[model samples]
Target: MRHAILITAYTDFFHLIDLTNSFNEDFDIYIHIDKNIYVSPICLKILQSFPRVKSAEQVFHVNWGGRKHVDAILWLCKQALSLSTDAEYFHLISGTDLLVKDLQQFCNFFDKRKGTNFLEYFLLPYQGWESGGLNRLQYKHPLDQLNIKELHDRNVYNRFVNWQITSRRTRPLPNYPIYGGSSWWSLTRDTVNYIYQNYNQNGWYDRLEDTFIPEEMFIQTLLLNSPLKESIVPYNLRYIQWEHKHGSIPAILDEEDIPKILHSCALFARKTDSRISKKLINYFNNNRSSNL
Candidate 1:
């Protein structure tokens, strides 16, 4: 049974190298590099050194209200499926992620669920244009209250227009359902193929991906609505600390967080910066070979 370490990265290519080198487990690495990010010569060299890494050239310029992120991930999923049809599990990891356990143990734990999924689900707000549709139709936005400027540039503008002009215009609108969960997941081949085969037919997926993709919600909703919901493990194995109350993303890991990280009992922890790299290196050097 084969497994893959799939990553969607922007500027932190080196961090991947550091993590990859420490893990001796046999797994293929597939990366989606954002075209907008400027890759340095050193980055290219590091990427080439990893024999298992397949560099995907296709990049998407995702915008705040655009479907580009979803498009990029969908493209990556198809590429991964084509490259190796035998891959049992596709483990999605971020550029900022670090392994907390030995690679063998990680593989062992997942091997038990060879044909299952690790995706979870929760209903959350669907952002961008989709939100606008619910606000207008569901809340009964007055004709003058409709802001065309907000709808015109959003990726779902066309869908919104159709809904607005058609049966939705005069009918009582239903609440817009959304999804949320950990962005990271380990998907079985069966589920992966299902997504590739029915990319567009599903109304909720097509509509959801229009604004948010490769995040907590999109995959959660897709999997929940699929036959593999029974296989989903409710909790993700990553440990993340949303350091501040106001920040959208988590705080970068520093030296001070090492002890806490070592005891987190998670397979991986994310957002480690150069400040914590030495501690990370030392920890891996001391414990990388162990089952811990």
Candidate 2:
């Protein structure tokens, strides 16, 4: 079965080269680079060498904690789905994540468990969530961009209008139980298609368009509420360490984390900066060679 690596990248081109090269040609890559990033000729050459790597011509200027971030993922998903109608699954990963296992191994794992989605999720209003994560569903803003002029355009009335109008969510609470999880997931093409269709056809995306960090909620809630929940494996297949509580970024993984990464049984590990740890790369190379 073919897999699509749907990546949302902003920086580190060589790292991206390392990432894309690691996966064989069988797995097509669909990437959405940040609009602000300029791709150098050499980087473009490297990416072009991969026959299946497709980059967006009109990349989105994604903003953290905003709907644009969700937009980026959706854009990549659309491209990936278009890449191949028969692509079995799409694994949402970042540029910072590296494959810990060989593609053959990963395929074997997925093939054995065909029809099951490796998506980690939890029913929302869980422990440690302030307001039971309800604020993520209630509020919507204009989503100020990074430009000074854009940010300055906000006024009291705009804020009031956003809060007053966006606060009134049309999606009935408890009827559709909200779900939460990490941004990365591996789901079937049908599941991803379902999300894209539901997002457009239903009012859930509009309700979440202004909500803070809606990426973690919008897709998860839909999956949990759908019949596909029975096919979920409950593991994201990625090993990422959230060292800092309430931290927006995962800690940069190093050689020291290699053992734990190897032990986690995850197909990939996140935030692994190759510059920080060549040893980690060597570890993967050595281990992957042995597995081969």
lDDT of each: 0.63, 0.76
How close is every model to the real structure, measured as TM-score? 0.74, 0.85
Q: What is the lDDT of residue 56 in candidate 1?
A: 43
**Model 1: CA > 4 A from native:** 56-58, 125-177, 209-214, 245-248, 290-292
Clashes of each: 0, 0
- Worst lDDT run of 10 residues, candidate 2, spans 144-153
Q: Which parts of model 2 are misplaced by more than 4 Å?
A: 56-58, 141-175, 245-248
Which clashing pairs does model 2 show?
none
Model 2: per-residue Cα lDDT over 1-292, one tens digit each: 9989888887777888888878776788887777767888777777866887866343677765678878888888888777777899899998888889977889999899878888777877866466677766665444545322245444642565456656664334545678888889999999998887777434677677657678888788878778788988878999988775223257777788888987788998887766775688778967787776
lDDT tens per residue, model 1, 101-160: 777777788777667676645654434335533333233222222223366544345555
